[model samples]
Target: MQVVGNALVALVAALHLYFLVLEMFLWTRPYGLKTFGNTAARARDSAVLAANQGLYNGFLAAGLVWGLAHPAPVFASQLKVFFLLCVIAAGLYGAATVSRKILLVQAAPAALALLVIWLG
Candidate 1:
């Protein structure tokens, strides 16, 4: 159960890293446009904003990674909970302001991982 929880946390971190890449490096590219459902002109115009969002995602990822690497078990769990909550909050906000899909795509996984962590 602990291993599963940890793996799920890692998966969430990886997802955030992918998001960082998409928003920071590819926001104006075809892949980013396709993923985001944005037109080329819109993507280009909003690239800076996307990059800023990506940086935040990267910070979340970094926090999760740090939690995973922490030496103290209790502190590690606390860190994980904190970061997961952050992800969930961001996801809910994005869903409300941007798209409903963000809730499922970003928040659901973190919620699952949080459940697992709590159970474990």
Candidate 2:
């Protein structure tokens, strides 16, 4: 049970790290072009916004990592579930309004994390 929750935490952290990379460093290149369907120049024009978005991803990762390291209290589990839900909701909203792939890429891991929190 503990192992499962820990794995979920790690998974969520990894996903957030990936989001950080996409939003921070790669938002103005071919990677972002492929991801966000924008030209290089357009992506470059929004670097500051991308960096801001990346910071949120980093925050999510940090929260999950902190909960993973200190699981003595049930608060950790609760927080993990809460943050995952937020991520999922955001992903779903983005997917519905912006892109369908966001739902798959972002919400799926969150759903898995929710499962771990529920059962573990």
Candidate 3:
């Protein structure tokens, strides 16, 4: 169970890392435009905002990785809880402000991992 929980946490971290790449490095490219449902012009216009968002996503990934790597179990658990909660909060906000897909794409995985971590 602990292993499963850790795997889920890692999965969420990886997702965030991917998001960082997409938003930061690819925002003005076809891949990012398609992902965000933006036209090239729109993507170019919002590139700065997307990069800022990507940085935040990177921070989330880093936090999750830090939590997983912590030597102290209690501290690691606390870190995971904190970062996961932040992910959930961001997801909810994004869903409300940007797109409903965010709820499924972002929040759901983190919520699942949090549940498994608590159960484990």
* TM of each candidate vs. truth: 0.98, 0.87, 0.99
lDDT of 2 by residue, 1-120 (tens): 868867977887898898899999889878777988898888888889988989998988888777777656688777787778878887888799989998888888888878877886
User: What TM-score does model 1 achieve against the real structure?
Assistant: 0.98
Candidate 1, pairs of clashing residues:
none
Candidate 3 weakest ten by summed lDDT: 28-37
Regions more than 4 Å wrong, model 3: none
> Total backbone clashes of model 3?
0
Count of backbone collisions within predicted model 1: 0
Per-residue lDDT tens digits for candidate 1, residues 1-116, read 98999999999999999999999999999999999999999998999999999999999999999999999999999999999999999999999999999999999999999999
- 1 or 2, greater by TM-score: 1
lDDT (0 to 1) per candidate:
0.97, 0.83, 0.96
Off by over 4 Å in 2: none
